[model samples]
Target chain A: MGISAVKYLLVFVVSVLLQVLFCNNILIARVIAPFIYILFIVLLPFDTPRSLLLFLSLALGLTIDVFTNTPGVHASACLIIGFLRPVILNLITSRETLESVAAPRVKTMGFHWFVTYTIFMVVIHHFFLFFIEAFTFEGFLLTLLRIVLSSVLSIALILLSQYLIFRK
Target chain B: MKNLFKLIYRYHVVFLFVLLETLSLSMVVTFNNYQRAAFFDSGNFLSGTLFEKFSSFAQIFEFKQVNIKMAEENAVLRSALQEMLLKSNHGTYHSSDSIYLPRIARDSSQKAVYRFTTARVINNSVNQQHNFITINKGRHDGIKPDMGVISNGQVVGLVTNVSENFSTVISLLNSKWKISAKIKRNDYFGSLSWDGKDYRRVQLNEMPYHVPVQNGDTVVTTGYSSSFPEGIIIGTISDFSIGSGSNFYKIEVMLAADFKNLVIVGLIENKQLNEIKHLESLNKYGN
Candidate 1:
């Protein structure tokens, strides 16, 4: 348990660093900003306490907010997803499957299940983030376009990391 | 009371979620107001140092482009200097001696109006509706809020927040930031603001339709605000049209500065800003 806790802490730091140094810099098409830092919250062990998950989400989101200069947008989005993670997990996986699997990774949960979970989570995150950043529905279509494009990029990166780093 | 406590305990996660969201959303609202300097920004110590460190590595890839732009700016300055020397020797009357003189000489003749210092952009974003640029200079470097920032002889942004070692600039691409601008051909002025649609294009509002504005006509700063001096090149008129039944023309300007490739920027500190503001306040009270 002690080693596992240290490992999770390492993942948190790595995710935030990767996001601030690498992911934030890649603004494809001038609108899409890939946010893969949510991987820390998304891939947390399913048996993790609900309160612990929410707190961790707040920390992760606030860190990204500081780097990007968007104070509360990422925080609010992360909170919503963190609170809903279990409900979404319950919707997707059976009781026995979740009890056996330690966390939601491509290696443990299989490709299809993990992809669906990531898509749902990333979409919720980016949608809330972009709209809150906009703060208005003035150019509703344009904001929606940005959310879609950014989510596609973020989802792709999150899935790729599962294979490349979390395979073991 | 016991039942209430039990109910709270039963849904404590939901309550915690709501409380946290409220805190975050309030932060968003306060930040949007533009004057409340929130501490949760990249300009703070830890993140600012982190951005500066990583940006140094990333900027290595952009050095070639930065070098080329600097050389071009140097060439322009050199030609302007040559012209000034030629005119001075000819005894020709130059309307503005202060423009060509150094700060020491200018201060001897008249109060220094503006002082400039350059800084490297450690972080910048162009896509967001409320975009900000972070620079390496801050309070220790004499950077303060409300100072104007320019790059490549064009408007880049205005300083909004200053920390110990870094400052955050409100980018021109931000929809909330508006600057006073005028047409070069005619003295007609208007408020220039971004539409959150394009980074390269901004809208110049309140220009009466009767003014003969044409495509390619240069738009420059009005000098009405202390943030910028008179006649800084903002952009050229791209496309314009008047909405039906409206007296003003909707002028679209293509910004001169390519914000995406910004590396170095000049900050303009208005020395007379406080004095002017002080006098204005006194006049209001005196009346």
Candidate 2:
């Protein structure tokens, strides 16, 4: 348990640093910027306590917010995802599968399952985040395009990281 | 009490979700409503220090490009100065000796209007609807809210929040910010705003359709506000059109400063801003 705590702590710090320093600066076509820090929330243990999951997600979002100069937009998006993760997981796979797997990953779960799970979570999170950040429906088609492009890029980065680093 | 305990236990997750979401939404509302005086942002100490450290390391890579631009700009300024000197006193400037010319550029009649402090860009974002820039200077460096920030002689943003060693600038690309600007050719002023679509192109509104704007016409600050001085180059007109049934021209201006490569910026401190504001307030109530 202690080792696990230290490992997760390391993940938290590394993701936050990678996000603010690296990912935030990648403005592809002046619209698509990958947000990979959400992978931390996506990769949390399946059996994480609901309250703990919500708290961790909020803390993670707030940390990104503090760095990016958006106060509550990210926090709100992350909180919604944290709340809905269990429901989404149940819809995707059986309760028994969730109980058997220690955590959701490409190695533990099949590639198809991991891809499906990540797409759903990332799409939902980006939708809420970008819309809230915009705060208005003006030029909404452009905003939707931004959300879609950013989500695809974010999911690609998350998957790439999983393959390169988390393959044990 | 047993039944009540069971109800509370069963609905605990829902209660928690509502509580947390409320907190988050309230924060969003508060932050959006109040762009100035931010506390939980990069301008705060911990993130500010982290970004500053990171930028110090990152700025090394841009040294070559920055040096080239600086040299070119210096050459242009030197020629402009020479022309001004020659025009002011035709025969008196016989020799190009350093001692004959006046040391201070401002004569006694021209009081110093603006003072500039150089600051480094530690953090910046342009893709977002509400883009902000963080600089490694703050209240200690005489930077206050509403001070205009320029880079490479082009308008960049306005300072909105300041800490002891860091400040956040509301980038010109932010949809919420608007600055008064005018065409350099005809001097017809309009309100310039970002449309949250593109960082390079900003919308110049309230320009009457009869103004006869053309592509590549230079736009500059109007000097109507204390934030910016008159004739600071904003951008040149890139595209323009008249919307159906609208009396005004929808102008698209390509910004002069490249926000993507922002490294160093100058913060302009207006010496008479307080006096101007105070007098304006007096006229409000007819006192």
Candidate 3:
């Protein structure tokens, strides 16, 4: 694997481990549990193959599910965000940038584009995850609270980590 | 075949998305414990009513068998009652005597702790994020909010809303509903809540780490809430673990009631619920 590919692999393993071990336990107000594992999917190279992206996201989600004992909840939500990653990236950046950008990060996409991209993907992922986890709209407000809080925490963590690790 | 192959290759990305989503969703619905329950949650009023009608119709065909079973049970109950009457007439009966009776029958003179009202589930949904069961009996039938609903002998859900002739139940499979449950063996109680992925399993939270919970141990409602009676079977413990730096065990319970095939259910009316709520509300204001 190339250096960047190796780095991506390392990021995947580290993100999944951190999510399973630490982030899963950090429940603020018994609602906001930060799911930083989606960071790996968020950070994949912009031009990653659609099929490969889907498969990798499935593996990542299922792995998290195995650790958390939630079976397919994570996998389902992650697959959705993964499939939409390209679309979200396309919408936020120009064709030239999309072709040239190696991976989505604060430095590469600039702060504005990167923030918007992260917010879209994180919101979609969290919305799907919490709704599927609850499986009903009866507690619309509670589910919304969980989605918003978790997305904020996940986005903050993703952005902070990007700055700390990928900053030039 | 060539044209089909071309079409498949052309929209391969969309096809793959569909395939992966299908796989993931099926795994979620099939493997998780609550989706199956959601299937019969009675949230979808039309389909739920149709299902209830169909099941009840099917039940009519088995009435002969049911009557036989009921007759046999009644015979056994009569013999048991005869023995009790004999003991009492012989002046050998004591209030503390250990004669096994259903919990509802223990208090001879006092009002029943639980009054069961049979209701047919009219609508249900298990595939959704939040599931509710609509039952036929409602305010007209004296059904009220917070009543516990059950099928067969297993805990089902709680009555959350009631209309003049209909009521909605918050299924146990719903993530919003939580019940106080305990291990049948040790009386170690915890909060049982659905994870929304499975219809067959739920999570028991706040179980102390010291409790030696084992797989397959029975979990039952703790009767801490007026919603459900004490000792109603919820499920069996399927798995459990203590997370690092946590003092509680995270337990997975396999629900006992098959939510996929819910038909006739009983709504439990707690006679003392209003009084308890009134007293508790008074205490809340420190009055």
Total backbone clashes of model 3? Answer: 26
Assess each prediction's global lDDT (C-alpha) against the native: 0.86, 0.85, 0.75
In model 1, which runs have C-alpha deviations exceeding 4 angstroms?
A: B36-38, B82-109, B282-287
Question: Per-residue CA lDDT of candidate 1, range A35-83, in tens?
Answer: 8999999889989999889999999988888887888888999998999
DockQ of each: 0.70, 0.77, 0.14
Q: What is the C-alpha lDDT profile of model 1 across B1-287, one tens digit per residue?
A: 99999999999999999999999999888887655455777888998998899889987888888899999987976786677567554332234423353333233445546777889999888767878899999999999899999987699999999998899998998888899999998879999999888888999999997899899999999878878887789999999998789999999999999988888898888877787788778888777
Q: What is the lDDT of candidate 2?
A: 0.85
Root mean square deviation (Cα) for candidate 1: 3.2
Q: List the residue pairs that clash in candidate 1.
A: none
Error of 1 at A42 (Å): 0.9
Given candidate 2, what's the lDDT at residue A3? 88
TM-scores for chain A over all candidates = 0.96, 0.97, 0.94
DockQ winner: 2
Candidate 2 residue-wise lDDT, B1-287, digit = tens: 99999998998887898899899889888777437436676899999999999988887898898788778756864785676567664323323322122223323445455666778899999868888999999889778888999987799999988999999999998888899999999999999999877889999999998898999999999888788877788999999999889999999999999999888787777767887899899998984
TM-score, every prediction: 0.92, 0.92, 0.49
Stretches of candidate 2 above 4 Å error?
A: B1-5, B80-109
Interface RMSD of each: 1.5, 1.2, 11.9
